[model samples]
Target chain A: MVSDLSVLLTDRQGQPYSLTSERIKHLEYLCESTRRDIVDTLYKIGRGHAGPSLSMVELLISLYFEELRFDPSDPKWPDRDRFILSKGHGSLGYYAVLAQRGLIEKRELDTFESLGSRLQGHVDSNWLPWVELTTGSLGQGLSYAVGVAIAAKRQAKDLRAYCLLGDGECQEGNVWEAAMSAAKYRLDNLLAIVDWNNLQGGVTLEVMPSLEPFALKWQAFGWHTIEINGHDLQAVLQAYHQARQTKEKPTVIIARNIKGKGVSYMENKVEWHGGTVTKELHQIALEEINARLSELSQYADEKYGRNHG
Target chain B: MANWKKAPIREALGKTLVELGDRYPQVLVVNADLRNSVKSIYFMEKYPDRTIEVGIAEQNMIGVAAGLASLGFIPFAVTFARFASKRAADQISMSVDYCRNNVKIIGAYAGIFTGAQGVSQQMIDDTAAMRAMPNMTVIDTADVHEVRSALLFAAEFSGPVYIRIGRDEWPVVFDETYTFELGKGRWLREGSDVVLLNSGILLPYAVEAAELLESEGISAGVVNMPSIKPIDAALINDISRNVGAIVTLEAHNVQGGFGSAVAEVTAANYPVPIEMIGLRNEYSESAPNDALLEKHHLNPPWIAAAAKRALDRKNRLRC
Candidate 1:
């Protein structure tokens, strides 16, 4: 099973654009299934940040299924690309992707936030090997990614570091500090993705109105900035490829997306940012995600055949 | 009184870091834009490729250190104790301590040594704040020798460590033969009537106070406690049991510092009368180093007076 994954994930030419359409369709299906898992896990746990997690599904799917290099059996594989979830409250999406990638057992998703569970409320590296750092007290993950990138460059390792942050977490002063240093060091191997759903605890506008011209802020910090619709798989993939091609500077993708992207009642709803899902709502969410997954799988079968050739 | 050889604590720290950098290839230095002040510039000069400058971001410095640690690198992050403890406390707690990263956090200009820099620069609450953190080994070095030994110890020891060093020149208390052991207090002088518990740049004052107590026909024992978190409870208990009275001195606030740590140990193990001589509850203004010490009642005479008061209280308990 691991060998099959390695064969599929190995980029012979080191270009993600060389991936087949079948692989992209398979990744799209995996993303839908991951969304279902996230909703189900949060509903079972009785508490979680559903809105933020839902918003980051496609971005994580792109990284885990298409961009990142790793052996699910050997998570500590040296030279493998690294990812740090700076906005760690969105761990539901992260854990779902990890499970889907076989880095963690799928059944473990049921134990999230439970007693003695590795899946804590926040990302804890001590509890899991795949988690690179303990985060949740926002704005620290990007700096950590910068450190990893620096180490990779010093060692001349063929590796890259990616960090995912929330749009709300940009308010933290440490983020800009890391941004400045990464650019100053010309860490071209580092990438930062901001989930620009634009709503924080309340609306980001209501909480703090200063984040406008966000991409320009990254540009001002000397980063190569890319703006894309986060929910669009093709745009996310293209942005990542562009980031890889850029040299002598760090890159940040301001992925504009909706808070609760796939669910009908939860979409764009502030209440779902960190609220418990009722049994009825959970059922509705699962039905919607399952429908999407079925549509994606059928499309892949019809377009690329059952073997995804 | 003979004058002792003195040197700035930062120079000793820089020298030791360079030595460690040579000995351990994985040893790295992370500075938060205070390279000149923290003396990490020396390390940067020696190993240009090994030094990481995070600019004025203490929080980012700590997080980066943790990241390096996760990759099995020994990253010593340097910044003012004031900022390292207060400004980046959350990162230290969550990113480093919680994750059990082998990151050495070197907090320079701890206590009242940042004298003219005023209360904002001074770190009176660092020991307390770092001690309260789980999986954090807190060490406050006394002299240049101890500073060198402490940095060496931090380089070898795994897990999170917060080492506090002062900026001003301090009297050399230990010789070249001095060895540093984590979680063990060093006994400098021996007496029976009272115990002078001290740490950091204030050790010279405690030694002076013990001598003063001797001239006054009082027997005072002096012990230097470098490790503040896993404090030498056995030594503190023995001193409390044998001496029956104690006087705790530090350049930090009396609350949640060396004094508070000793008091807690004695209160739980051996309930002996202890007098804590430190910043009672006020911030130090921008004054000279000596003036700051004098204003905070941290001079030798004040330490001797506090020892006498503890002895008097011990005598009163008999009545």
Candidate 2:
């Protein structure tokens, strides 16, 4: 059944996202394809953050493909929902998703960190106009996101602001200051998602100043907290929807992610956070990811109708 | 308005901001609990809805202002100069400057020894610190009139601006006809012997020193350089050509403040014998304005002495 694709997939104002077998299958394809592109690109680039980039693949896929509303053609469209990549080292993953939407060109992707590549090591708004906030330093994006949300509300516009921050990024005092102000303003339209990968520079959170009582901390800051497995697409979508409906307060989704997810050897390996993906290891990782594609595709078709041939 | 009636520069900022709000609907103020002291409270009283109280968080205040600027609202983020420069430097660099967000950062009680708030509060590095950041326009108005003009200038001007203002009521230097032009300096007095180029509240001293030099047969010119960064190099070059000696002044460290900018201008083109008059590579003590000014040789008599020293160096260079 072909449905009208014009309405935004974000909220009740648009066609709210429902979990059908075919839709889930398409989202899963996007997730896996995004990971493949990232791994491929990072391999070519010779140097990049792979683990943190890999950890947030599903989240970015869910945001760009289904939840966050935007027109790729008119990127600077006023009233378009804004997204802040506060965890700026995750630029490769962001660039991959943006490329899928065809926002970033192939040449730009090839020249990722090299000269003339608009895509800097960190997210740069000067290079990418729609980047919203060119973030690299942690704990600042949520404040920018809150400001955006405040501006939207003041203008009586329905556009929302979303920020994706690393687990380690939350340790910044600015984040809590932003959190306190966001709560004070009762910014219902502002949603922050923490990539709770439990690692900072390959060290466990326990060793670092831990975000151990993380959820309660947000709760204490008067935020509606949603804890979920970061890799779970269904829970991710549900958390986003709940956040949109929540009023009189801001919402935070503590996506407990693995620093290096998906590929067997890389998964949960702290060292892979900054380690190089050799050509030998790249091939093995691709095969591991490739092996799951057909099985998931068949299972999706068996459970529900097919979205594509 | 009395010609020399001392009024708070922050008050001028607050009053003018309200006028800006009346005209520009997109104008907003982001305060970190310094409204009463910084005098953004005037704008706050007039437009409470437009004022965003971030509650004493400087970094978050800047980020929020950037966010607002991103969405087309012009946000004036106000905080003490020291906190804004040092505490939120990275945020200003990453979120505002690098992103090219059109936000106005008001640094209050900057480099003023009269603050009594302690040496920690009096910031001598705000100009030096902000001047280093790319895409930041630094403006240090000398009085109420210039502060008023600066607020008007900042509203119409696009991109990031760092405006240094004083917390307490201070002396007025400019008249009613005074208008602000960024990247330009107004030559207040024409003296061939020596010229004192200065910005912020120290312009009166420069003028008084120039008058004192005239009595001593020393033609001392005075240049009000409000636009600190992207400084008027041509004016400095022209003035340097006419004058034998030059003195650059600010309530900041001579290392990277107003003096360094003037020296860079002349150094690049026509190198001149410049005696930079400022805090002599040291921290300022929390004292009365008169004591600090007198102690630091920033008052008129000391300024005249410095100009003579510069003249002596110029004479020595000729010899």
Candidate 3:
């Protein structure tokens, strides 16, 4: 495997147009299946978090396929790239991607929100592989990631540390404290991706402008800032690649994405933040996701036929 | 003991890390701006590469310690007990304890030893908060000897360990040869009239109290209950049966310090009129260490008074 997975996202013609169609298909599946799994699991659980998890599906996909360097067989690989999900409410997206990458058993998806399952509603590092820090309490993950990044630099190791943040969670003062430390240490190997889905709980970002001028704020705090379409897999991959090339300052990729991207009824809806999908809603979500899966598969088939034929 | 010979617990902790750093390169120290006060300056001066000062940011210091621990480093986060407990408890709980990270948190300036820093800098109930966490091992060493032993023990012990240390240079009650275990309580003295269970700087006074009690025809057992969370139930049970009464003391709030931990064991297994002698749910203003203890009814005279009260209660029960 390439040290940087972004190298794998070649174009449809195998020329690497920012991102390949194969990788794009993977991103879409990650987003769809995450929503599907969360809905089904929640349906079984009788309670599930839908909004925040759906919001970060694309980021998780781009991370798993385009950035992080790790072995699924040996999850405890010391030299592996570390990923810290600071906005841990989006854990469903992480669980789906981990399962898809074979880091965890696919059946583990069913265990989510269940009593005995290692897959919990909140990410637990001890119980789950690839989770570097245990987080559900907001504002803590970034600081931990900064710690990891600083350690990597001290040891002269090339290991990169990535932290995913929620837009609403930025209201916490501790995030800025972590930002200052990361910048002070000049941890260029660290990358913080904020899922700017605009809503937190029952309120939208407009309802509470916690971090306006967010990009400039990071830049002021001594970070190289980049803004991109979070749902655009190609942009995410390209930005991640650029982030790796940069040095001396940490990178903050401000990704603007919808809370619910794949499911039409759920898109941008605040009610779906942690609302349970009833048996009836589960059917609708499942059907909608299946439709997207078929559409992407058909697109892949058409592109293959045109080129090969 | 000579004045210069009396060592602060923080000195022992810092000194232990240097010895450990020689053996294990991964043993790191994270200190706040109080390195000199916390005695971590010794480690910083000796092993500059191993020690890091996170400035005045307590929360950041904890987060950085957790991060270092995650990368297979044994980080001893050194800071004042007040800031370590209140200012950065969330990071300690989430990044450290919740993840079961191998970080030894050495809290300096615990109890009224803060002296003139007042109640703001003193940590009266830090052990209680740390004990509340499932995976955290809370240790309150009675003196410099116990501190040195506990710091070494924590290195071998897995998971998180929080050791509360006093700021003042305390007299060495135990010798360097004394073996310090993590959860086991040390039997300091044996008595039959009443059991004086105490820890931290209060042990010396408890020993004195036992001596005074002996002169008054009351044998007082002095048990140094350092490991508060894992209360030595068997030891406490033995004290309850052999001694007529039990008086728990500390330089802490009686609600959740050594008294509370002993009370939990005694309540279920052995019920007795346990007199909790410590700070009575109040903060102390800037004053001398002895004066602070005297005001909180934790000094030798106050401990003697509480012991007498317990003895009187014991005699009434016998009648």
Q: Taking the tens digit of each residue's C-alpha lDDT, what string does model 1 give over A69-135?
A: 7767788898788899999899878999899876888999999888889998888888888988878
Consecutive 10-residue window with the lowest summed lDDT within model 2 chain B: B1-10
Ranking by TM-score: 2, 1, 3
DockQ of 3: 0.64
lDDT of residue B12 for candidate 1:
88
Provide the TM-score of chain A alone for each candidate, in the order shown.
0.91, 0.91, 0.88
Report the C-alpha lDDT of model 3 over B1-319, residue by residue, as the tens digit: 1122466666676677778777778888887788888878888888887776667887878888888888888888888998887688888899888888888888888888775788788888787788888888888878878888888888888789888888777767888797777567767788778889886778888888777777778778888878876778898888777785899988788878888888898888877768988889987789887677677887666787788898889889879
Off by over 4 Å in 1: A1-20, A204-207, A299-309
Candidate 2's C-alpha runs over 4 A off are A1-12, A105-108, A298-309, B1-3
Report per-candidate DockQ.
0.70, 0.85, 0.64
TM-score of each: 0.94, 0.95, 0.92
Q: What DockQ would candidate 1 receive versus the native complex?
A: 0.70
CAPRI docking class of candidate 2: high
Q: Model 1 clash pairs?
A: none
Superposition TM-score, candidate 3 onto the true structure: 0.92
Worst 10 residues of 2 chain A by lDDT: A300-309
> Candidate 1 vs. truth: CA RMSD?
3.5
Question: lDDT by residue for model 3 over A91-206, one digit each (tens)?
Answer: 77788778765678777787786787778788888777778888888988888788788788788887999999999888987888888888878888899999999888977778
